[model samples]
Target chain A: MSRLQTRFAELKEQNRAALVTFVTGGDPNYDASLAILKGLPAAGADVIELGMPFTDPMADGPAIQLANIRALDNGQDLAKTLQMVRAFREGEQVTPLVLMGYFNPIHKYGVERFIAEAVASGVDGLIVVDLPPEHNVDLCDPAQAAGLDFIRLTTPTTDDKRLPKVLNGSSGFVYYVSVAGVTGAGAATLDHVEQAVTRLRRHTDLPLCIGFGIRTPEHAATIARLAEGVVVGSALIDQIANATSDAQAIDGVLSLCSALAEGVRGARA
Target chain B: MPANRAHGALLPSFHSPVENAMTSLRTGPDANGLFGSFGGQYVAETLMPLIHDLAAEYEKAKLDPEFEKELAYFQRDFVGRPSPLYFAERLTEMCGGAKIYFKREELNHTGAHKINNCIGQVLLAKRMGKKRIIAETGAGMHGVATATVAARFGMECVIYMGSTDIHRQNANVLRMKLMGATVIPVVAGTGTLKDAMNEALRDWVTNVDNTFYMIGTVAGPHPYPAMVRDFQAVIGKETRDQMLAQEGRLPDSLIACIGGGSNAIGLFHPFLDDKQIKIIGVEAAGHGIETGKHAASLNGGVPGVLHGNRTFLLQSDDGQIIDAHSISAGLDYPGIGPEHAWLHEVGRVEYTSVTDTEALEAFHICCRQEGIIPALETAHALAEVFKRAPNLPKDHLMVINLSGRGDKDMQTIVHHMEQQEQHA
Candidate 1:
């Protein structure tokens, strides 16, 4: 099994949802971002999503958009992002790490080179927001063939007709974008998320992760009861955006990850 | 598939025996929504089902006579279709090499070819039972056009314009507001066309239930590029009929400025199968290509995906999209439409660039010679006319898509004139 599958299986055995913590790679600066990544597993994060920053992150909201700009301004490129992954992997294992972002940076980095380096750099999965199943041959098929799990984001807008197509080649956990809006938009109702989870359960057996509009531990706890994993991106990245220094950025993200994890761990208690 | 040509040259004249032997360039973007490897539905999965529904609806509307009748009604009576293809007597005399004709898209309602697409999209929105209309604009022509159609159709309209563009194009902002559109200024990413487009996409993703995103140009995912091209093709169709009636033959060449390439594609698509007419798309070179400050994607860019399609984009080596600069807000986009990228790659269209300086000169000349104030975006195409017209044979007829009027561009032009006077 892939690292993602292994992690989720362990989480299932524990009867708790995985706390999927996300932060942009090299945000604010390289050292601080690497510090946050290295501390995530210790901070109780079950899965880590490192954002590969691109200038035009159209799918992101203000919080994550600012995160991408900060990462890029601090001279973070694909090469540095991969290097950060390698460094994080030197100290960390078992916790599945997924690189999430748009497709252009990967395209420019050369897809083959990106997949090869990602696999070698201890990257386990990808969550490309702009790459729908329609163009799966471009990246998804190739990456999956190379043993890298290709996660698909199934939104509220994806009806029953489209759900199977989205889940067909999907590995890792299936991401349920709880809202029809961009990242960091208003949270969906628990009722809406519940219905979506039930519908997604009918489609595929892949573990389902819920993201978008998830912020505080209370919200994470609420979603943890319904899905296999809970994703919090902008909420954690906001910690970096609000930090006075690199040390605070690392502390802010790790501490929040611990708190969110605590909420997810005790949700079923 | 047509046999690939070595250069950006047409196959042959339409009557040639080779014409039937080869495939048509018009048939493109196979089932996967690709024009070669350029165009595709690269949007988020949230928008995919909607895009597919739109494509299906568009295909149905293309076949339905009722839809055709309604579209024709709006085109003829509302948006003023069949904008004249007038022979530019002064421009032809000034060039002293070719007979130049102006495809006067500026005379359409809302004063640009943008209304052509807006009318078609608004009608589609109504057909889809959408209650709200949203769009992204750069110079505000498209915003104003979208606003106008939305008001006419009695729908709630919202337009996203870049903060920088809103400041530069204040007149268009007011015009959009006067038409009842809520003009939201996007303050992200240098606050330009691409940023506004990003915001608009966000809006569409959020309001996918009852909203229609009437894209202003021939860009975006799948059906958008092809649909916008079909709506704008009225320009080429009219020019074909007008030129044949007036000059007794098809024009030898066609030229238009390309930002997202709506106007250019509209004018070029009908002629793509002609196989003899030369097609040229002029991109805005804000400074120059060498300075790395231009928006000439084909000239100074590589193939990459953005705004839901893979196209030629001005991006850094790290794949960060470099901000594109142009005096004309309409042309200040880092990427070209995916179809244009395909055309450039397949050698069906020659793409070039016109610096801000050259476009300004052409703007002045067109105003002085034709007594017509041309949009700064249109001026880029005019600049190319000045370059190529003077070298072609006297009987070599040329059609330039006068894509918009200069009314919204007066501020930019005045600012440039002031700068020139100060430097002098």
Candidate 2:
């Protein structure tokens, strides 16, 4: 089994949802971002998503957009992002790490070379926001072939008719974008999410991770009860955005991760 | 002849739905909305089903006689279609080599070729039962055009423009407001066209239920490039008939400016299968292509995906999109349309560049000699005309797409004149 499968299976055994934490690689600077990445698993994060910053992150809201800009302004690039992943792997290996961003950088990096480097660097999965199943031949199939899990984001708009197609080649887990909007937008109603979760359960057996507009321990706890995993991205990036010093940025992210992970751990109690 | 008055108007060929044969180079985006690997439905999964629905609706609307009839009615009565193909007599005489004709898209309802796409999209929005329309604009010409069509169809309109563009294009801002559109100024990423598009996409994703994102250019995801091209192809269709009627044959060459390449594609698509006819697309070289301060994507950039499709983009070695610079806001985008990319790759259209200085000179010449104040974007094409027309044979007929009027560009032109006077 892949690292994602292993981690999720472990989580299922524990009868609790995984707390997936995301942060842009090299945000504010390389050392600070690396510190946050290394501290995540120890701080109770079950899965980590490292953002490969690009200039244009179309689907991101204000918080993540600023995060991308901060990361890029500090000289973050694809090679450096992979190096960050490798650095994180040197200290730890059990927590499944996924690299997420737009597709242009990977296209420029050469898909085959990126997959090879990612696999070699211990990166476990990918969550490209702009790549739907229609262009799966471009990256998903190839990445999965190389042992990197290709995670698909199924949104409110991914109707029942299209859910099968979206989940067909999907591995690792399915990210349920609770809203039809961009990242960091308002959260979906619990009723809406409950219905969507039930509807999606009919489509595939893959673990479903709910993301978008998820912040605070209570909200994550609420979602944790209904899904296999809970994703927190913008709220944590907002901590980095609001931090005045590098140390404060690292501390802010890890503390929040601990609190959210505590909420997910005690949700079923 | 009155320059703005279109004469010898005939029913445009688009009124009839003709199934394009497979052999024609005009047929593209086979089912999947790809222009030979350049265009595809690369948006998020949230938009895939909607895009598929749009593609299906567009296909049905094309074959339905009622859609065609209504589109033709508005084209004639509302958009004032069949914009004249005017002979640029003094420009031809000055060139002293080729006969030059202007496909007067500038005289269209919103004073640019943008309305041609806006009309068709607004109609589609209405058919889709959408109550609101959203679009992104650079120089605000497209905003005004979209606003006009939304008002005509009685729908709520919102336009996303860069804050920098809003400051430069205050006149067009007022025009959009007058038409009841809410112009939202985007302040991200140098506050330019690409930034505005990002904001618009966010808006579309959020309001997908009742909102129709009417992309202004030929650049976005699948079906958009092909659909916008079909609507704007009236220019090329009219040019073909007008050229044959006036000059007894098709023009030997065609020239047009390209921002997202709607007007250029509109003028070039019908003539794509005409093997003998030459086509040239001019991109804006802000300072110059060498200065790394230009929007000449094909000449100064590489192939990458941005704004929902794979195309030639001005991006860094790290694949981060480099901000494009052009005096004309419309041409300041970092990427070209996917069809233009495919055409450039296949060697079907010769893509070139014009410096800001060269375009300004052409703008002034067209104003003085032809009494036509061409948009800075259109002047890029006129500049290319001045370069190639003088060297061709006397009987070598050339048609340049006058894509827009310069009424909205007086402020930028005045600023340039002031700087020149200070230097003097």
lDDT of each: 0.92, 0.92
Residue pairs that clash (backbone atoms under 3 angstroms), model 1: none
- Runs in model 1 deviating more than 4 A are B1-22
Give fnat, all candidates. Answer: 0.92, 0.89
For candidate 2, the chain B TM-score comes to 0.95
Q: Can you give the TM-score per candidate against the true fold?
A: 0.98, 0.97
Q: lDDT per residue, candidate 2, A165-249, as tens digits?
A: 9999999999999999999999999999999999999998889999999999999999999999999999999999999999999
Q: For candidate 1, what's the RMSD?
A: 1.9
Per-residue lDDT value at B7 in model 1: 44
Question: What is the per-residue lDDT of model 2 for residues B1-424, given as tens digits with 9 covering 90 to 100?
Answer: 1211221231122322452243456778777778887988889888888888898899999998999998998988988889999999999999998899999999999899999899898888889999999999999999999999999889999999999999998999999999999999999998999999999999999998999999988999989999999999999999999998998999999999998999999999999877678889999999999999999988888989998899999999899999999999999999999999888876778889999999999999999999999999999999999999999999999999999999999999999999999999
Best by DockQ: 1
B1-424: candidate 1 lDDT, tens digit per residue: 2213564455444565566446678887788888989989999999999999999999999999998899899999997788999889999999999899999999999999999999989888989999999999999999999999999999999999999999999999999999899999999989999999999999999999999999999899999999999999888988888888998989899999999999999999989877678899999998998999899889899999999999999998999999999999999999999889988887888888999999999999999999999999999999999999999999999999999999998888888789889999
Q: For candidate 2, what is the TM-score? A: 0.97
Locate the minimum summed-lDDT window of 10 residues in model 1 chain B. Answer: B1-10
